[model samples]
Target: MSQLHALAAAAGVARTWQDADGRDQVVSDDALAAVLAALGYQADDDDAASASVAALSEEMSRPPAFLSVDIDAPLALPASLAAAEAAELTMEQGERRSLPIVRGVLPPIAEPGYHRLQIGEHALVLAVAPPRCLLPADLPGVARKRLWGTAIQIPSLHERPAPYGTFADLREAVRLFAARGADAVAISPVHALLSGGTSFYPYSPSSRLFLNAMLVDTSTADAGLSDQKEQELIDWPSGLASRQRELRRAFADLTPEQRQEIDAWSERQGSALHRQAVFDALSLHLDERDWRKWPADYAHPEAPGIAGFATEQTEEIAFHLFAQWLAERSLAAVQGEAKSGGMAIGLIADLAVGIDPAGSDAWALQGTMLTGLTIGAPPDPLGPDGQNWALTGFSPQDLRQSGFAPWIATLRAALRHAGGVRIDHAFGLARLWVVPEGRLASEGAYLSYPFADMLRIIALESHRAGAVVIGEDLGTRPPGFVEPVTDKGILGMRVLWFERNGNGFAPAEDFPAQAIAMTGTHDTATVAGWWTGRDIGWNRRLARGNWHNEETQRMADRSALWSAIGSGTPQPSADTPAPVVEAAIVQMGRTPSVLAIIPLEDLLGLEEQPNLPGTIDEHPNWRRRLSGPLADLLAEPATARRLAALIEARRA
Candidate 1:
């Protein structure tokens, strides 16, 4: 009823929201004013709220330059366009034709692409997308009715060769797993990370637009690599320096033809590649990690000074490009090996929802990305204080103005060489919790995006890539959101820990066919850890939450999980946990879901999960390396048995 509340709601801010504990908390006026300011509005009081509302009204009242719709779908235009008599449509490939705009709706596009629409003095970019993404059954020569995969955080895979494992180790995994009936290997975000002075976690990437330079193993030089010992935890800084030195050495050894090839690849990548290279080059001179903290002269990519800087530091920019090129070649070879080895879906790439606000993506995507606000989560049962990811995301308004090119670019990059792409926190496409800088996570507002348009773009990109699309659609979602994602042929992710039906685990067969079935995500506990309450113990030890009081509930969950797995009652304790680790895999394999991916941790029955949410230094997150080499994993009896059972069930 308050004027500030009205303006906040109108500006896509949730004034009152229900927390995970089922308690309603109203958004404070300060939070509203801060979030509104980030959105380019100013509302500190009732009068300011009215002014902000008026400003929004005035801005939105202008004619938009772009609109998006699915192919053959109704193209609804604004009321202002209702008076337009005729418009000229220009397709991407230079074809142009005039069509009538009848009753404010343009004719359904027969083709999907970026097309220009002209109505006298008004011109708009129209993005028409394909109906749905590539599906499992649509893959050429896919034998199994239901597909299955194994998900792993690549860097965490402990192998003898390459120390902390490399693209080379991952390549060998395809040949080994393809024979074992694993069609896909879902990886953590391989998006380019800041090589030096950054967290090793793959989720919080510097730039989703590029590849991690250090993951590329440029060698045959190290004959003793096969015998190299693995580390318990990845020393990212040292590892990156070692890999970069090797990559530089190889680059120096390249011939004229090889140099030309690198130059050609850079040219094809165009502006996006150059922009990122510029950002990386600038980092060498600037002490500040965030571009926001940099001198105003070089803060933005498109600034006049950036071009001069790029020219002055051509070699530095080239080094970054060379690194990306190496990573790309290695990644492409892995995917090629997967397909050649008879895998239907070679690799599944993970796409982090947002980019680091201080990273290359933020520098490049100035038009489409929002810098003043950070994406976060509302207060939830898992974390009572909520979570601040401290990442920047796309601006819904600017995305439309730019015709969603940045989004399209990001998606294409992820799906380029993968058999499937898993979108982390897919609910992000619908809406995001926006927190202003210096604000607590709980004091944020849910900002809405152009969900329908973004989904269509994703579907279009998915079809073009001929890759399956999987969305990690967990957390708070808008009503009827999952259905649309599934309907668009994008598989929704379902974890075992959350798929409860009336206080009991949902039956495997009851799992939806258009989804990805899994025991746990990287953010959750492993099957072995959850069974033994190791996750709860870690939480208590790390002082993350009040998990010490949830032993009874945690045990109850263990019993329900085993009961759902048809393993009678579970008597899980510290020393002797229930024998449901492999059973859990069996249950997941039995699901009617299109694909079931078992985490590597669960496959090895590791007590320590790959990642423990909410703690960095307090816990060993993203540090657990695999027990042995890629081939040794296949030799494991658990791997053999689980793969055999999963493949047999899917085949049947």
Candidate 2:
């Protein structure tokens, strides 16, 4: 083997990967060197490669600070502590016990939590996790046979007072869905994005630790900010300006009691919340969104000057703290309302795959986060050039050393007020395609993660939060990925467009019972949109590809879908999609999957998707609002009929 290949192997970088076409794609030597360099390895020459390999080995030889093991799974002690005869184990709840190590193997922990184990002078955090994540059937008062929900883009609610939806609107929608016999409402990511940025993509969050303060309802405070006229698309810039103005006014008007309350709540959140608030304030003060552009001293969370800045900018930081507090409280209320209104699973929050490279998470966790690397995909059939997401995530080595602290915190934040979580691009947990910054995405290598360890941590968190975990495993998963994911009780996604049998759609009954069935995701075309070739129209207008061929394929797909739903039902013309939309909803509902989520667009028979994948500015993604109030929309005869059909099919 080449020295570079040895270095790459030592660094957990894949030397070769399989592309979407099932062909082996070898990672170029240059790509491996680049990826390894990003991982802090200097492998430009054979000598450097050997040196870096030795360094990595030395690092790996050291005992990890933390270890995650499935409950009842025997754990082998680190070599340093292997000779210890006995170890003292401190449970998370302050309970302590002495354990005998039988030939370096510690007995399995029956309970799941972060426990401290001490062997002589060596100490490590042992995370005992449940065998699997919480299942949908395990949810109280939920029927295992069939459960259903609606997927909504929170901003699309478009209620009064504010042009875009807030948690207030979300609460109303959740109640409405619960009344319609829905068990859950899977909503788009509400992770904290830029405070007043031009880009309004929810998936690219500033931080996954905190809520999006802009989504908090400040109307109750009568902040006196002018409300924009209700429109089909969200004017993100204008709306963000209004939101900031409103938040400032609301913060100024906070009573002494309110200030004390927010301070107390912020205190409970600890340094993570404090750091986030400081980042927001610093951004406003420096008038720079990118932390890298900020003066070096003030950019990092632990920088000496940052503490002084936080002290001096107390008022501004307070406002951000107040904003976070309000957002969390509002979302908590929505979850509460859903549960009280008879929903079994309530809200299922979407966890974005990664955070913006220039965002707060990147700034705060710079040491553990990738610096010169960004996450993306390798060249595939769908994206011949591959795709760069311009996002950064935690380092696998750092995660092991940090006891998975950041990851656990992120999971806790996502499940804080929701009954479940849908991990976006869940395959990323096993491995992430990492590209060197400024490099073409195709020039990337797959970085292996501690898949088994991460899965155990996820299960531990899931059980602790009593939340079901649904992995968005819809696309090119690694070989042997699904079985482990399934074994861990992480529900996989089954989308209507992708559930295929040759040219025809798969039978509803054939869908896996452990998966979550959905009509479509925010990125895909809506049912009505697909039937009428609205997506193809966008592709043609954008000059994305040969739209004529896409249109022809869509026509055939429409026929195949109609047949799968039932040939007895008359096929509707492409222009008339109401019948097809209704049947599609019913078809997905009939799936044996524990959870079926129909996007609101499909339920309303709307011919527009919330997002178009390729076009950012050209497509009004994440901005389109519902035609009317959710309650009224649900009351419409057509929507009501489709929903009723869905419920009936689920029950059947």
Candidate 3:
């Protein structure tokens, strides 16, 4: 490719001019006309192209509005105080400074508390605690609450051809969870996926903010018209078809007065209605392909036909809004039920790093997104080939210029109906590995971001929402990742499988005090699967000739692993029963971490994982449904007592 093309591609631009230095430069109207001439377009007909170039230039200069924040002027210390505290004040990179003070300009120091100081456009904070310790009161928000949750895929709730089960089934699940002393249920993304069998993956959603209509329980609307007896199992496609049919019938049966009420409600939620409308239109147009393949005129948000399309899909859009409202109501009901039944926290939600590049958030906020690049992990022991999530992240510069609006918007949405939020790939807040278009994952490089500013935004939002934040700081973490975020009252994540210090699973006493301890995550094998050697066996088979890949190499490097506990046998199998693995995890619960979350699969002695990292279609990812009803699973004598004992011990 030409240098200009390379630069344009890197910047996620389709057409642009370049400076003499080969840098992609903002093209002037006249310069755009010259480029068009070179591309065979007549100069006399360049008015449209010239206007487009001018608009693009304007957008490049003015960043998104949401990323902006105001910082107050720094307090000027008196001459005497400056002289007295000269040794305590330290100058840092670029205009930032750390000083020892009772309190700066933001507020008066009340009992040696840390204060976040903002001076003009610069934002920094001071740690004003006692000599060596940090207290929760010194942080920006309330002390982080413990989060206990289980991961569930909304789509997996379906039996076969049906989309999802009845609301009654969901209610029963909540009731069963309460009986089992479970606090929260962490579910997969319920974002609307493309319908018509386009893509089954829930993560690659058509819209992030909207709820998936497939999950809606139509029985809650009008009971008698739907056949309650025939609903056997979840058949996603069939279930969706049945729900749609029932929804249409219910709409027909609605009186004119009822229709008016719905319309009035839609009018009140104007923005939500508009967003849903956009999603409906886009879903209809794209079918299965990405939005970029759409006709040229339709590509731009200001295209002539876009408004009409939005109008046409209004009712369908309203239906989507109604679905979200119902989901919120259902979730609240679950939380209330859990609380009344004696659970401490209810419904800790997981927030994925980024939306699918072809999804709604990316489409709506196109200008701010880093479109051509994909977010992925650096080479790690788990996946020697590394991982490219195929998701697009926001540009750091665009995020700052936009006042970090997209991040805030997403957090606010997740926190809206959640008790706590688990930030997947939380390390990305500090820096992300960005692989440019068509590049191998190894070619990716790290890009730094203003994490402190981002954390400040998160703290402010979470504090206001009365929700806790958990950072999933697993895998090869960067230097000093935990200390600052933990200091800010965000809890760290601890997985037993990876916890070790020159020996098998780190001693229970060594676990951190402010963390959520669990045996495994959605990406890893269940406790039973791990002990039985199923995870390693599967990895070995998949790796084939690359069997000695980096992951295996790491495992070889950690030969001391599992040795102290007396498992000298090299090749273990799934024949190892549940009780043994359960004991190991229960031991972890005795640690000082504020929270302990045991996956239901592990709790039930299941050998399968919810998801496998590298493979998508090859494995049954997000398809595993609970083998039995929640009530039945909770009633198993041994399972119930063991779990209850763990909860009791932890509570003590």
Candidate 4:
């Protein structure tokens, strides 16, 4: 079919250029001969020229946009004068490298001294000139020091009754973590989501710049709205409803002077106000659908109605901006408390790879975004079918040409109140699989980028912010991902489960010294779930076709392999408890990896993992709340002291 169409297209082009007879009634023989020859047809040929011509015409008529030129045009460089002039211009431009711009100020690190750094899978040896500090000098004076303090999830920490409301509860939670010897608390992404009965997933955020208004502690009254009692369990729907009602009542109760003050404050932060207006407009337009499915006008962000909507939603925009300000203030307070409580690294924030295609970042920077491609993963041993995240990412060419404004802006926001930033899917710096929209993930090809340039930008921004960077270099890492990251003083992620030797899992003592070691990530099963065979069982159930049987057999093989290790007697039914897993992880910390982060769930011996990969509704993903309150967790003296001792020993 394709060959027939190609012929038809060729015939059509030949026919178009054919000359007509002098009388203009019919084509000349010479012209017909020329057309036939151009279409690869011959007068004496046995082949059917008509069928070929018809096929070629059909192909040409289908779509002109699909046609492409195949040219290898060589550059015709000018001689002497022009060449010299071009060289001179190039030299002048090369000398004028653009200075790095600072968009926002970050609070400085407490101690700004040279510290030794180790990256998980990379090695570096620095030679310093006289009067300059050497790489060894930057190493911490003590061996096996931790990169940061303990971490807790904010949502889990404050999951209590309504009277102990959002912000008030968070305040108490922060204080609790500080007293518990935690220097940092890593929380879920708090980006804004679709309001009015939407999925409460913090990750699939509608806007990266705006704060999740749901996280706003309504107890902190704005414009005279008093806190109200409500049902427990952080009922998102009811909480948003109550908060909106209170906001309306507060607006009504505000005096003219108070209204004026609010208006003045909004006027002062014009950019933030404008962004909020745009976001509100988009929310109304999108209405639970991705922006690509919207009307053509709304699809292109710069279309006429976008700016007008921003102008109309002035007060609503101000409200959103106010919410962000409150969130910023609260986070800063938490950092201050952590610092006061003797935390070395106050907050370690996670940065998501990309935003929803219909998100604020994409809307505001449409030109910088890739319109037709979605970033995803290739098929691997763990995920045989491969995975598509359904999120839009910045094109490397566009990002580079735009001076990395979008990347810089996102980093600045995350690091503003964080002591360290963990870049999710950090391998994205090298290459990203760009699957065309509506295409399968397997069809995607790797698109390379200038990794060194990107890392330089990251290092520059991080250094300016005084924040350490931990690259999540898990999964199938690309060749040479470690070198530049380590050279730039960034840390690497080390997952104990995936750390293996040729025979089986590597011993904990063999783990790298410069990495941030962990038992598992949000995507993996918890210690209890892994022990009980729940994770493998879930995987088998989710497997497609005969894959289910294959996965089950694979699990059995893994069990047998574990038995061979002689670490413990294998149960016929997998049932390794949290204590065993915890002990293994503690032994991992005893390795060279300077930092270790134990999830609070593992420490508490929870039965379920925070998230189960490959299942959305089938598994309880991001919504799991801790069984006990923050105070109860702190009061668990034996558990707390034991974990603390491990951390201290690892640092030693």
Best by TM-score: 2
Models ranked on lDDT: 2, 1, 3, 4
Judging by TM-score, tell me the better candidate of 1 and 2.
2
Using lDDT as the measure, the top candidate is 2
lDDT of 3 by residue, 1-652 (tens): 5333333333333343222234553433343233333222323344544444455445545422322122232444333232223223222222334444433222223222223443334433342332221222233332453324455555444222234443345556656776766666666565666544545566666656655655666553434323432343334455456666665565556678876776676677656446655655566656744667776555656667677777776666555555555555565665577567665555666777776776666666777777667778655555556567888777776776666667767777777666677887898888776665666664455555667667767766665565667888886665567777877678787887677786555766788877777778888878777665567667787763354463555455234334423235453333754555556556655777777777777777778887887887666776666654566666798678667656765655
Candidate 2 residue-wise lDDT, 1-652, digit = tens? 9889998988889999988878998989988999999889998999999999899989988867987788888898778678889989999999999999999899888988899998888789998988899898887877455999998888888556575788888998988888878899999899998765675799999999999998888775333322454566788887787777788888898999999999999998899899999998888888889889999788688888998998898998999999999999999999999999988889999999999988899998977898799998888766789889999999999888888889999999999999999999998899999999889999999998889888988898898889999998978999779888999999999999999987589989899999999999998989888989998998888988788889888878888889898547778888898888888899898889999999898998999898887567898988887777788888899989999999999999
lDDT of 4 by residue, 1-652 (tens): 2333234335331112111121212223343333344324443232555556565456434311110111121112212111221111111113311212122211122222221211222211111111111111143242334543444555554444442235446557667766766555656676666554444666676666556666656443443222323222334455566666654555456678866776676677656446655665466555744555666666555777767766767666556555555566667776677667765666777777767776666766777776666677765655566577777777665665455667767777778777677887888888665555666665554555557656755665565566667788887666577776777667787776777777666766677665677767777766566666567677666663365565566476455445433357544445546455556446555666666776767667666776776677777566566655667765686457546656665666
Model 2 TM-score on a 0 to 1 scale: 0.97
Collision pairs in model 2: none
> What's the TM-score of each model vs. the native?
0.95, 0.97, 0.73, 0.71
lDDT of each: 0.80, 0.88, 0.58, 0.56
Total residue pair clashes for candidate 1: 3
Q: Model 4, which residues run further than 4 Å from truth?
A: 1-144, 147-151, 162-171, 195-197, 220-273, 285-289, 293-302, 540-576
Ranking by TM-score: 2, 1, 3, 4
lDDT of the structure predicted as candidate 4: 0.56
| Model 1 Cα lDDT, one tens digit per residue, 1-652 | 7777777777777787766556777888888889888888788778888888888777777778778888987787887676787889999898999988888878888899878888878888888888888888899987457888888777775444554667877887776778777788989888887655655678878899888877787764444444445567766666656566677788778888988899899999888888877787787667566787888889787777888888888877888888889889999999999999888898999999888887888877787888689998988887678789988899887887776778888998998889889998888888888899998998898888888888888887887888999888887666558777877888888899889999599988889988899989898888878877888888787666677677878767766776788556545454554357777888888898888898877777777887777777787777677767768876778767766766776676
Residue 144 lDDT in model 1? 50
Question: What's the C-alpha lDDT at position 418 in model 2?
Answer: 95
Pairs of residues clashing in candidate 1? 158-626, 192-211, 192-212
Output the worst ten-in-a-row residue range by lDDT, candidate 3: 85-94
User: What is candidate 2's local distance difference test score?
Assistant: 0.88
